[model samples]
Target: MPASPREEDVLTARELYRFYRAGEEETLALRGVSLRVRRGETVAVVGPSGSGKSTLLGCLAGLDEPSGGEVRVDGVRISHRPETERARLRALHIGVLLQTRNLLPHLSVRDNVRLPQRAAGRKPVTSARELLAQVGLGERMDALPRQLSGGELARAGLAVSLANSPAVLLADEPTGELDGETERMVLAMLRDRAAQGCAVLIVTHSAEVVRSADRVIALEDGRTTAATAPAGGAVPAEVSDATG
Candidate 1:
């Protein structure tokens, strides 16, 4: 069956199209978009408002269904699957950090980072404390989400996102709320994740993120404006700047 998708490709979207319909009215959000993010590579999706960035991410992450097209993660097709099945696959292979931080208010930072794996009945690929340390939240692991500042909250959310050590790391505007210094730190952590063999897909409008990515894909009016990447190339290593 077409050899399934290559396991090395952590995320894939083929001819993706989406439309929202309401009482005979339709809004096209994406049109025939296709891309792949390979293991250890970082790809940036950059576009203006209403350019289908978020919609495209949703489809790729198995969070939304496309009117037409398919999405696969690590060789398994996740598109059009049952929501429960999608959620299971996401817990096992996908890490998402959208605009709203996905942190539990009641849980301590360490527990929040451990929640995903625990919910899935799987051991964490990395320890909560070590992962938090990597994201510069080592000391804040005992604190609640409400006790964290904006930057700290972002860091905590990021730690939680990596709890299961997902194969495909999808981030939307991860540095949007951070100061310049904190932004640099977060970006550096993402790069480090890429270095460790995670396929990093980031939807962002930041010039810094675009330049840091190994490839850049731009969308305009629900279509691809540009995509630049070397075929089958491995992303290079990067230094972490998370040291406080």
Candidate 2:
């Protein structure tokens, strides 16, 4: 895929490679990943555990730097930027939903969502109330994180992720551990974001997420094994290795 300028693409990765090194040993987590996610599209990265799903997300989110290749989010080259700079861009243009560290237990839903916007260093931050309502948590905005049920907490986390009207959204197993109702709500919110022109990328095993995606990229053993693009999908490539 061509890594064009940001006029059309919200996210782009060109020939990405990531490797971990130890004494006399090395592991390649990603090998030559190249793709593009345009505005208003949801792309799902699906594979078994340890197939470099999290690593891919980290690289895309600028939480980790790739050993080779480039990544751009909303026109910013973040693949190898300093952590501080990356965090700055992430605050302004990215919304992240992960299984861990998504919410602060001591904070109310409203406050939790506000925190990131406060640090985002941007004016006209997203409205907490509007965001909460969009996720069907308007009535629970003032409730503390620990005071909510599992489903409510999930919705709350999503509201927090969208606190800044991010241009690109990154999620890791966003529907995991949620009840049926909560899962549907989350999925709908994700699709809605895409419709609103926010590029959404998720690493997931959930059937619902796969179904919701405009495209699906499957990885195995740290390399892309197969990919189903949105337009004129191609046959899945070959597979390799034992586990992810």
Candidate 3:
């Protein structure tokens, strides 16, 4: 069954704008992008490269301060919080999977998965073994990053992202490094998280990812000008039997 939406949204953004200043010019990455993700909802943000998909994720995750507008996560306005507070809140409540697998080269997969818990000043509640198993990395828990295949490393990163059982999961190009089958597996895991009541948002260019979402929001030239729900009008299935 689909999880119920929380009375309060898990994530809300209003008129968000981000701009980078060069010596004599400014580049607008996001312009007036407003979005909301209710608890138990899965939203996919899609656009071509440089369309500000990643930038939107960063702003939503509180990794970057927006040049203008408001962003609230878990009902708190994190966009204006102090850096330390933002970092602390993120550690406690947000799970982020970036395009790059930013694992520590010296740490084994198990250790890397537990790092987030340690950073949050909490003992790891979710067993690394269990998480690795969920990601199909149970046998590779002791493997170092260099010894793992690209897909294995990606799964490890995902397991680490779920370390806190966060209220929100933010993934950017999560399946970019995986093969077709692995990508399906990863998306299924994400769908399971949303089914379990986490607000899941993925920023990707993949058609498969978009189709898996409850809603698809498209960005063009730094603005969200298109938003659509699936034609069937039923909630997305947990897993699609079809393949890319």
The Cα local distance difference test for each model comes to 0.82, 0.83, 0.83
Candidate 2 lDDT over residue span 31-93, tens digit each: 988878889999988887788989999999888999999989887888787889998888888
Write the number of the candidate with greater lDDT, choosing between 1 and 3.
Answer: 3
* lDDT, candidate 3, at 172: 89
Candidate 2 Cα outliers beyond 4 Å, as residue runs: 2-6, 229-244
Q: Rank the candidates by TM-score, best first.
A: 2, 3, 1
What's the distance in Å from true for residue 220, model 2?
A: 1.4
- Candidate 1 residue-wise lDDT, 133-203, digit = tens: 98888888899988989888888878877888899999988876677777787889889989999999998
RMSD of 3: 4.8
Q: After superposition, how far is residue 144 of candidate 2 from its true place, in Å?
A: 2.0
Most TM-score-accurate candidate: 2
| Pairs with steric clashes in candidate 3 | none
Error of 3 at 62 (Å): 1.3
- After TM-score superposition, the amount by which residue 97's alpha carbon in candidate 3 deviates from its true location, in angstroms, is 0.9
Cα deviation at 83, candidate 1, in Å, is 0.6
lDDT by residue (tens digit), candidate 3, 1-244 = 1133246589888889999999989999999998889899999887766889889999998899999987877877889788888888888889999768558899999998888888788866678889999888999999999998877878888898998889999998888767887888889989999999999999876668877888888888899867778545542332232331
